[model samples]
Target: MEKLLEILNDIQPDADYETCTTLIDDEVLDSFAILSIVGELEEAFDIEITPVDIVPENFNSAQALWDMVQRLQEA
Candidate 1:
């Protein structure tokens, strides 16, 4: 979670990641930011975020992203 926060902060320092629940819907993260986050997440978590996994529900918030990462790890 700390590492996720770090990456998110690097991408968008102004947004409150800890409590944000509408990252995508609120337009908090644009295409470039999302792509950057995808790269960072893939490298940091040692996971591959394929096109199928790039959904708004999966990137809604920090907890959602963490949940997706954990699910992918388990798989």
Candidate 2:
């Protein structure tokens, strides 16, 4: 989770990722930011983020993203 926070912070340091749940819905993470995050998450977690997994619900919060990563890793 700390690693995830680091990756997220590197992408957008201003936003409070720990508490923000409406990241994509609120436009806190725009397309460009999402692109950055996807790249970072893939590289950091050594997991491939399939197109099917790139949805707002999976990316709306840090916990959601972490859960997705864990699922991908287990798979």
Candidate 3:
């Protein structure tokens, strides 16, 4: 989770990823940022993020992203 936070912070240092749940809804993360995060997550976690996993639900908050990563790792 800390590593996920690091990734989020590196990509966008303005928002509080720890508590923010409307990252996508609030436009804190645009398309470019989302793509950057996807690439970073893929390389860091050694997991593939398919098009199906690119929904706003999975990218909304830090916890959601972590949950998705764990789920993919298990798969």
Best by TM-score: 3
lDDT string for model 2 (1-75, tens) is 999999999898888997999999999988999989999999989999999999999999999999999999999
**Every model's TM-score:** 0.96, 0.96, 0.98
Give the least accurate 10-residue stretch of model 1, judged by summed lDDT: 66-75
Residue 33 CA displacement from its true place in model 1, Å: 0.5
Residue 29 error, candidate 1, Å: 0.3
- In angstroms, the error of model 2 at 72 is 0.3
- The C-alpha local distance difference test score for the whole of candidate 1 amounts to 0.93
Tens digit of per-residue lDDT, candidate 3, span 1-75:
999999999999999998999899999999999999999999999999999999999999999999999999999
Residue 70 in candidate 2, Cα distance off native in Å: 0.3
Output the lDDT of residue 12, model 2: 84
Query: Tens-digit lDDT track for model 1 on 8-70?
Result: 999999998989999999999999999999999999999999999999999989999999889
